[model samples]
Target: MSASIPQDVFSAEWLALREELDARSRSHRLTGLAVDWLDKRSAGAPYGIVDLGCGSGSNLGFLASRLPGPQRWRLVDHDAQLLVHARRRGALLRDRAGSRVALETHCRSLSPMDRELLADADLVVASALFDLMSRSWVESLVAACAGHGQALLLTLSVDGDWAFLDRHGARVEESEDIAVRTLFQTHQHRDKGLGPALGGEGPAVLASILLAAGFWVESDATPWHLTAGDATQRGLAEALVTGWHDAAIEETPTQAARLGAWRDRRLADIDAGELGVTVGHRDLFAWPAERG
Candidate 1:
């Protein structure tokens, strides 16, 4: 097994830029799965949720209004700074019934995520996190949810497809772009704290794992379809291009010049408002297969 990456840090700006698209792109089918689970459950008391690797509480912001109210959430993350912001944002969550939410924060790493952490949670939710996790980590999560009879929703796991389109809605033919994407996919498997990150394979791998663990898994494509009119999407696309460029260069230093040229062309197209980007992702919802 490979050693984990130390201290994964995501800038606040990066989180803010991508969150809206995340919210927009999340699959309604998966949301419906979770909602149906909530509705079927006995509503004798407030529902409890645990959000693993909750970055800035975007999951809460997107889900609070949809889930049953009188909810209590435990938002967990390794970053103290993000926890601070999540705490502030979590306190403001309200369900559709206009009831105030109770929120708590835990600053801890994902390793050794024990049953105690999830003992009282009705659901486990995480956004944009599964791709950075190892297969074992996801299996562990599935096992934990099964053992405790909890439901789970994991959103925005990358599916490793990126399509760039010209103004006429046709795919652009760029060999350099394809090369960079291939290299970036290779880079995605590098250790990112959870051991050998699954990257683009997350959704499929996790669905299989959940099914084997005896959970009813529901999945849908949650791709971000970005065009020139969406400023946030454009900013996110630019950031994504820059990050991929850097990662590709780091992965293949000798090809830095080629990746640089590819980056320039992508950015130029963005500037001309002629670029369309589609990033593939998947949203997944799983519940206990037994449903006792």
Candidate 2:
């Protein structure tokens, strides 16, 4: 949410770094519900799915094979470069029925989200995206999907809970850590190309909206547990710390020195294989009540 922070967090490198973690953090329970709902649909026709902010098609990759085939996907994102990667990956996927999936990419902003986006989509999905959206935007989306009786699976919405853990998997709490986290959370509520962002309150707000709209909703925690022992996880942990530090500094410039020192200590602990990070996220699956 830092105005100075480059908006390129969606860069291919960053997306790639977090892809595996995202996949593992997704709730199997919510995914299973989504699969069951999709499977119950009439067969022989392609299942039309629209993925909002589909970065490099990670959601498509995670869900395509698990879902029923003859599948047709529309991967949408503002980043043309990320869409390119998504389209390329989509070409290689086959559905649960072993049929090649049909795919298309849309390089467009999700702001002013319209019913047209949900018009042909039987299921609308997005991953790690709702946290960056405003409440009004989400309401518009739920209304659109409900109007079409479309199911929704929104994944990896940060629930604002995170902790640095010690070797024994216990939280390592520090005053500065708390301070940095608070500032980072404040930064999260700032505009992110889409009005004021929902930040950590996304999942709960979305669920409430869905319920009010008469859709059945289910949500589960899908947290990332990164330990320093694994090379890949260690890298992600470091990146997370740096990103948090930058955001915190941007939110409170006066505390830049303190935040920097805190970041350095966290990074050092991570490097020494003495730290682990747990980031809480939520995965939600909602469908029109009539469908349930």
Alpha-carbon RMSD to native, per candidate: 3.1, 2.1
Please give each candidate's TM-score.
0.94, 0.96
Which has the greatest TM-score?
2
Q: In model 2, which runs have C-alpha deviations exceeding 4 angstroms?
A: 1-7
**Tens-digit lDDT track for model 2 on 1-292?**
1121224578787788888888887898888998898889888778999999897889999999998878999888888988888888988999998889998887889998867777778899998887789999999999999888999999988877778988888888888888888887888888887999888888899999999999998989888898756666888788888988988888889988888889999999999999999888888999999878
How many clashing pairs per prediction, in order?
Answer: 1, 0
Candidate 2 displacement at residue 284 in angstroms: 0.4
| Tens-digit lDDT string for candidate 1 (126-245) | 888777888888888888899989999988878777777766666776788788778878888888767988878888999999999999888889877778545656776787778778
Q: Which candidate number has the best lDDT? A: 2
Q: Each candidate's lDDT (Cα)? A: 0.80, 0.85
Please report how far candidate 2 places residue 94 from its true position, in Å.
0.2
